[model samples]
Target: MMFVIFISFTLSSITIINGVHFRGGMITWEPVSSVTNASPNITLLIHQRYAWSRSHIPCTQTNIFNRDLIGDYSFNPIVCLSSSTQCNSADYNSQRISSDVYCTDINLILGISSSSRSQSLSLRNNTKLVLAFKGNDSWLSLTYGSPAGEGWSLPVFIDLTLRPGIGINHSPTSTMPLRINIPIGILTSIEIPMSDNNVNDVIKCRWAKSAGTINGLSVDECAGACHSYTLPSTVQLRTFTKNRCQLNVTLPYVGYYIVALQIEDFSSNSSTIALSSVPLQFVLYGFDSYNTRTTCMTPPRITNMSPFPTSNGGNISVTVNGQYYGVIVAQTGCVNDTETYIANFITKSPSAMKTSSFPYAQNNTSQYSMELQWTPTIDQLGSTLTFCAIAIDVNDYSSDPFCVNFIVGPEITTTTDTTSTVTVTTTVTTSTLMIMTTSTTSTVVATTTATTSISTTETTTITTSQVVTAITSALSSDDGRILALGLGLGLPLILLISLLA
Candidate 1:
């Protein structure tokens, strides 16, 4: 498989705003250049898996001041598909931005409607870039940010990033890269993290409880369907894929969940190599299986999210701020068992973030929590504008869900769209991972201390025959006997502490 690149000049960063026009990332970023010497790369850096590749088609560039979007500096425009139902045959040409919002991928106009699609564009400027996106068309618009969510407008943690499972240029063609637009409350922590595990890798997940009633729903404009996965319950969608290729299904609904991952042989039995094979790629810092001894895909880390109380008051525009983190390989889950970990957080959102996801090392322990501050509109604070915070990990519900309990406020009046800033004084934390992990949602934020405390683990001692044999064999030697005598139940405990920490 092969693909080509149409370089529009590298950018400092990538952001998707207004409606997938490509502003930067879910969170805002100024154009950055610390990494690439070139201008901005229009590839999405949300996840390295979705990062820029040499083969992807390059979208054009526009000055932050250019709003007309006139002229033919791009490839032939195409229709932006409205919905799967609207995947019409007509090749309607459309424009990306005009005067409302700052844009990126908009350089290449698409076919149909303007949507909140999740598309990535690699831009130049490595770091100092301030990326922002919103529907500024109407006064008091709707907005989301890097630490993306309904009211999450936070600065993304710079160091939380890690290498991706697949290279951005790995996609052979445009059709090959699975680009998707996340829905409201559906935070994308990882992208296309499909593992090439062999047969019988034994994928298993822990459950807080079983879902009594499972209802399926559909997103009117999306290609996938949503599931009303009633929770406090958990299960592995792919404990063991019946087929060898890959299990690529979309659950278009909201709730908690995580990748119950593994690899297997032809018999669908546990394989020795597991995820070590070449074709297999794991999320870097996510809640993935990076442990030495893998058990049923590492004990099913994280779970579905708890329902969030929401308000659509006046659709008033607001800005949110927060931070992010990631957990990598060579690291441990937030807790020893994924089930118990997720069970604590599941009460917040059926789809909450967890500590045990892929790409686990880097972000999981970084400075991801920041004070969440906001001022609601006079009309909203007392009415529609309600704010809350939840500290969620890569796996939405792998740990206890934190909240600042939301309260509606009256809509506040602003003098100009540029100055009046509403603040939500709260805290937020996010983590990333490695390998192919399927996690839940980003609910609230907790104190970094609370989160870090959870990272501490317990020590267990286990004695083996090797120890006794060494003891007996060494007894004959004075030094060996001394060493053997010193070795007791405490030895394993000490070793356990070192390993867990």
Candidate 2:
């Protein structure tokens, strides 16, 4: 369906600033061609999606100055809807910027106003060539840079008056799109976005059965209340508000349904002044399936595992950042089994591996983070371990697995001492080495040496190869292996590391 707006040229010259008026978009063109053959399409790069106005509110001046706005002009003489409640309307509001902030939110204007070219365009160099049209007034402000009679002439500026046309923020002759899935037997409130036409005009909207294929279902037959229904009469009183004109409905069935809606503006006398018909449309959805494989249940994801290269042999705290990690869902009396969750850890051959979860650590619908504690045994030295976590919901559905890697080892440093006498000093930084294995075979490498000096005047290097061989042989004995295993068994330790860095 096509709707035409008639522009009238007989409106007053005063600016209307306190209320919503007409809503529309914009267009662009070249006013004057440059001598260098630069295409006059300065704003051709701007997409039409960026150049939209609802209730006379425009986008930010930065969007305009950057040539991101269409029509190349600002819509002034407009009031901003800054209230938290008024600015959240899905139709007139983008929900991207704060309405309370000036130039950060769009303005909604209607009716008509007459202003000079300078007033309409803000008279700035960036806005110099813009041509703005709204209500009954239109103006063109331009600057000519080409050589005239002799040298560069003064910049040319022109302003003109034009007829005012009525504009709708939303398409008046088309059906709005609605698509959503809702779980059955659950009380839910859905917000339907609609446009607020004018303050003097009250909008009345209603939904009726539409005959056609909608959401892959026909409205010719009723699928119980779940398959089809209409908004309660009181919904009009509960849904419409200043800057937010919408419809509210409670759907209590599980099936596809076709719904048609119509909105009309009424004057204070209760007479219809304008009409908008939403084309027939369908909203498709089904009852929520509590299976783990259902697409609605997003799997858990790991955002970050901090403190990479974790040091061994110390108290270490591990922080895991993840989404849909695990949430505690309060159970209802229903037997659907959709509210239970269990979080577990998996690792390969961990030594002295102990686990503890933070009670009520974190919970959200699908976003969560958990803190875990563990200490590696001496036997796990120099070994890198990856810990994988998975969450299971009440319906036996398991989320995707997330893992983090950590290396177990202590910080090592070396030092040497030199004296007047010729001496060679060797040091084994740590005296104890613990090797852990399920097998019976064990290998040992040890260096035992004392600080000794040669009496000869000339520099002499003494070799302790015999002493090292003796130590290695001694450590290989059964008694030596028993001692090493005893030292390896110790309390769980934690490595303090920051994963965010």
Candidate 3:
């Protein structure tokens, strides 16, 4: 009896130390270089992003800005589980990419720290493999549910076999906040935006399985969080078609539900094999506003303003090696001012992107804003980078994710021409014609014509050359004006000018 009690105590201690830190995370990869005859090997850049409890990881703003690494946690390398033997080599199998995760951001209010890291690997062409990151048992306890002692795992499938028409395969990307709060007893729909470089491929989403084999790789996708919540009889859990993953749910009780989903890309709707499988997991907290007397409390919304020219899941273009600046604005809908205020703005951005300090007030109203600044390097040319953000109120109610794609390339300029013809018949009278043209880029061209009308028709041609000159002059005068204006008025006006320019 003494021996059994001692063994049990030691096992319990190990569980407490190793099981409670992981919240959620995802794994994605992109081709580092194009496949060519000279270089038969395909190089891929693998990205891993995870969130953990701040109490365990201990991350701060300084750590995030400095790109510090969380060195305490044990390394859990992502390994290959595919049946193919080519990708199962020692170098490609379970090599530890990094000692620890890089601290990218931290939320003190929620006590969650976000980490992201990337590593490069090379593999031969036509290699099909499935990679997964599996962890030991124990997830953070839920508010209204029992402790989840089951382990967690994330897997992504990679297919190197070129498509029939398309050249290479690129995996789909997705983003969301670590946690979201929804009102109980009400139907709500959440849309998870999915973007893929292979625009022709069909993207779909489904609930993750606790144990399954994807493309001959057997593993547990999501352990304790697999189908953890029950939805209404009439509501479907998700609707995935046309690069969209929408979850229509209505929680009956006030508690936390873990949503685990895998996004996969197929050649077509009828294709049986998936080109890639990316995992996305997050938490949804249900709260009751009626019980707390919060009569009118609604989630915040991203405003459709100047910088944000398009709505969620829209595309914004940026130039290579050019500075890009923008702002995200959100507003709450609580009538009773004391009910809630904007608490935080959680974001998932590229490693080099920088954001302003969060929880900033916007003129005492319930509106809040966060500034984003990034300069795409020359190496990032022709790449589509994604940035996603969400706003959380003091009551923990979160808005829908607002994600945008930044296409990097040369600046795209649009020009519109306006031509007008004026015919005046005057006998022995001289008339002066003044034509002014304005362009969308704020370029103005003025033309003056003095004509002597003696029963003759005069035709004057106004070409777009004048508009080009005006635009050139404006650009020359504002060569370094983006930097100056950005420093003075912050990034909002600068991004507006970037969009207009």
Candidate 4:
């Protein structure tokens, strides 16, 4: 009995130390400035994003908005772990960048939490380096793991080499949710949202590796959870495209599978070395009850509401120091209402952007909404920032990624021009007779005038014009006699004389 008790105590201690909290994470870097003249020396911003068990790393909405540090053991700084010359020295090996990851979001009910941190470092140009965050173990009991549990290792390859024409290189980014769920026995399509600043560069995706080096970095890309997906013999991938980062497959078994992939960018299709390599790790869950007898439940769809004019992938323009508001609405098509409902929202946004709490109530059935508010600062001017989101249901199924690109500052604008024209024609006539002449003489005069007006708002114009004429005539004695006879014959002569008087 004594020996058994000792063994039990030892097992409990081991479990506590391992903790099994890691979920998924990635690391990426970008140049601080677009200029490449600083060839030998350039500053880069390194960003890290990770998800963990909320039970292990607790966070609050307040902490997320305030960007407060997540108080946990994982807050330790990430260091260099590559065996290359850049990391061989004592100083380089010990080079610690604070992993001050702030709580980005928390879903206690789902037992998940996310955090992100970014730091800037000035390093030599045309150099290759690898940075990592290591942990004792990954999430508890992944579908494809040993009884002892697989360790958690996330390493990112940083290349500071400049492209031939594209001054500096920017790594590709993803907005895929950390977790996703699909119905069992049904084939589903998944497309990861990815983008790059260097539009000319070609991006590719591949499963993360456990052995060998990538881009000449001497380290395993993914530690233990490498090629961690275990598909049944009958199941085969229907379509897989590296350039688009898309896949179509069916998961027959009901279990959790890790999707560890590397997103790399190249100058062209034939380029051998990648400009930079970024890791995107997440989990895919298979469940049995996503479909019912009357109808087949599907993942929620993000509506193209106000501010978001286009459907899935679109772009919106904003200005610095101007407040921008956006609404994201999602709807599920499940006829059986009781089994599923929108639970939360997962987002990948720029720093300082704030998001409302999840599962906002709406009048429409099966509809959920969340609000995004942001005010771009002067520093972010002229930069195109990407924001991505996914609406998740209670069953862990998520909507297709809805990402919008925000073009910041005054680079893009809308201008309206209006023009109005007016013209007026006025004619004035005056007649005069001289008593000295025997014959009657008459003279007439006419005058003309013109005017123009112009008004502008940004750019506008208006115009105006006017004109006048004259005539003269002479009459003999016979004509005068005829006129007198006609006057005598006319009965209206008395009325005409009264008007003259």
Candidate 5:
């Protein structure tokens, strides 16, 4: 086997090289703090930190780079297209090494964003840099810094004698190599794109409908026992499955009792989990009766909506209103990404005026919106707001919802006044969403936006004489029979009795 030894220097560094160790044609590092690791064939310390003009981030760069390590040692490592900056602020055990070959067997280890690995060294965009490290005869080691606060540690110089390279050489031993397992729906540390495993790969999830064979009382008798059905194996996280996902089972009886459903996912040890499908959601009623259509509309073209309101942190329902630009929606993301709301609301009122509520509700074809109102019973000030919408395709399958930005508005105040005031001011942000009404039969799309401000005031007062008159009128109106018959008039009574006869 042609052995290839690779060394990686994460950042520009200056390490005191104590000595070097070579065995079986393998060269390693040993740190004694006695010898300084020099850029090979040159006199400069292997690592040196430079200021992006001494302070600012976004990396420091130089138009001309001097690779000659023999001189001043002050070559602001030239920026290059393939440097480490491609990484988001994060903690990575990645590296860049000098093109030289003295201790080729050992690679330098630089940083790992314990939090946002890419955040550190977020230096100037497209800035060039070089990887440098420290070494010696006894062990191989290096230092690293994290942008997301695990900060810098007292140079974590690994012991090379332990097995592999420089200052500290720890052998890769044990069943798992620092394995970390995160639960399917747990709140995880915010991760950058490059450092995380696909959330789907980490979990297996599926939704199920209620299935029972018994009808009426018989199905009620079979309540505890439910037959299981699996979704198409391909149905996955962030992926929608709209196949006729019918839950087939034996029905003993059928009645007006409500059918219930609960969603589940696979756990670490292959266990089942009953997730919070709050109120045990009802996806489709009469689920057992295949091909059941329950008052479908133009699929609720949500014209516009405000973010869901809340009283506590991260506990708001996701709400948003907007016109149907060339899209259809199914649900909105609420509290957690999973706190979804079915976009298609079944209204008791006839489809608003002209549009039909078929295949999908098609009210005002272009723009429409609703205000998500809530009065938090608890902590109103600490609440956060989010607005997200899940669009559905013509195939009836839902799409990944996109979230909109939300600004928190102050609570509405009610004040008492004895006089009328015209300048009552309340700030309502006008949304970018606007729908244009045309005299023609077809719907028109409006993209223009305009800003307008408004203010208002109100007054209240009461008097005893008015209250007494109101009471008398209320009493008279309540006596409907006498009022209709004209209590004290002969002609009116005769006419009423004749009409009644």
Candidate 6:
């Protein structure tokens, strides 16, 4: 006996029809399309089972339906479009089902129970197909399998691609303040933007006093306080997580300052300091002062020291003269009070020497003098000494060091000696009228010495000798006295003696 059976499935606007036939304890099915406009490329899978189970068995049990049922009657219920030839290979032969054959491998089914058998059958949007069951069973006792299979069938899986997203929420170039005024000791903040999807990303910034140019503004035009007078100093900017950055700065002087800010992400480790990129150049105004001068704080200066080149002698006294002996300012406790100024003599060469603090008097409103003593040790003799004197105000504000050069020399010692010496000589000649001559000679020597000691002691001895020749010569007391007087009074003689001695 033969009977006709109808199976209908509706998904969205697509519907599938199958005709089931039973003959001689065997089942067969044919698919039909209800809609004519369905695309042949579109695939469909169907899974069906009884809504209620008599035994209350879970719909997810994998073992309830066996692949091998009865003799050559294969239980593999998967199906797919005839175009997918692999669908025809599924049978009791037990070759692990290929996603190519099973439509379920591609995730095409909906609403399946555990006991249901799986079949992969691809149908055009509104196509029909005939399927057959291997064994004879009441339609009420029959359960359907997932059109594709239990899980994501095989090869193609829904893939979601993710892309990196990072952007600056606030444009540093457009939104950043180009100019700002910060008072002395006052803290100021500037905001940086971090607009990105990554919540875990971090942002960082570093600042330099000289930012060549950012956007169209020259960084040189934005000079203030420290940046105005010296090489650009770099400061780091910090932020934790909020994607917002704040730069806190304290202005030191009343002048224009230009700073270049560099931004980077912690994760990317990239910075915007490249020439192609533009960073904000901030023009910050500092505190207002009565005497508006573009100068950094000056340390004490030692202008002059008396003597100009001091000697590094034992216990030598030195005098330092200079100005800015702690100029009174708003920072100091006592305004214009010179007494609060402290002058210290520092020895730079000999780093081990302690700083010498001395009192300084304002010789005039613009200059000052301070007296200090330096004693040189034996080792320091002949060694050049370098010294600087710095004045510090009560507020700990210090002036530039006034440096002095010193020459070390040995102490002077004097010794005196007086000496007297006399010499006598005689020669005689007898003349006979151009015929005969006779000659005689005699000599005498005397020495005297006297010594005077001062810081150094010395002993001196003197000796004299002389030779005389004439027509007639003899020793004379008068000559001796004359010689003595001449020897003592002669300027050339003393000079000669001094040179010879």
Q: Whose TM-score is greatest here?
A: 3
Would you list the C-alpha lDDT of every candidate in the order shown?
A: 0.22, 0.27, 0.63, 0.61, 0.21, 0.28
Q: lDDT tens string, model 6, 125-168?
A: 32222222121221111111111111101010000111234221
What is the total number of backbone clashes in candidate 5?
A: 85
lDDT per residue (tens digit) for residues 1-501 in model 1: 111111111111222222222111122111111232332332332211111111122222223112112111122121222232322211112212211211222212111111111122332222111111222111111121111121111111111121133222211100011122222232233222222222223322111111111012111110010111221122123333433232233333432222212112222245432211111111111232223232322222222112322231112233221111221112224344333221111111001112221122224442132222233322222221211122233333222112222344334445432221111122212222111211111122223222221221112222442444433333234333223323433355457669999
RMSD of 3: 17.9
**How well does each candidate superpose onto the true structure, as a TM-score?**
0.20, 0.23, 0.69, 0.69, 0.19, 0.22
Evaluation by TM-score, superior candidate among 2 and 4: 4
Model 1 bad stretches (over 4 Å): 1-76, 79-411, 414-501
In terms of lDDT, the poorest run of 10 residues in model 3 is: 1-10
250-317 per-residue lDDT for model 4 (tens digits): 77678776666778888888876877777887777787765433243566777764664766667888
Model 2, 1-501: lDDT tens digits are 212121101011222343222121211111111111222111111101111123243433243222222221333222212333432321113312110111211212211111111011111111111111222221111111111111100001111111124222211211122223444344444444343333444555444332422223233211111112322232332325332434344434454322334333344335443322222222323344443333334333333443332222222332222111222121112223235333332111122222233213243433333444344444335444444443433332333344444566653444543222222122222344444322222333222232321121223222343334433343344335444433332111111113323
Please say which candidate is ahead in TM-score: 2 or 5.
2
Predicted candidate 5 versus true structure: per-residue lDDT over 1-501, tens digit per residue: 111111111121222122211000011111212211321111111211110101111111110111112111222221222224432221122323231211100111111100000001212211112222222221111111111111111011111111112211111100000011111212222110110011221122122223221111111111211112111122122211321123222222221111122222112224333111110111111112222132222222233332332221123231222121222233322212221223322211000111112224234232223222223222212223223333322222232223332333345545543331112122222222222322211111222122322323322232443444443443344333222322334344456669999
Consecutive 10-residue window with the lowest summed lDDT within model 4? 3-12
Query: Residue 249's C-alpha lDDT in candidate 2?
Result: 42
Deviation in Å, model 4, residue 34 alpha carbon: 3.7
Name the runs in model 6 displaced over 4 angstroms: 1-300, 309-356, 362-367, 407-417, 420-501
| lDDT-better candidate, 5 vs 6 | 6
lDDT leader: 3
Error of 1 at 153 (Å): 30
Task: Name the lDDT value of residue 392 in candidate 3.
Answer: 79
- A best-first ranking of the candidates according to their lDDT comes to 3, 4, 6, 2, 1, 5
> Which runs in model 5 stand beyond 4 Å of their true positions?
1-259, 264-279, 286-300, 303-344, 347-501
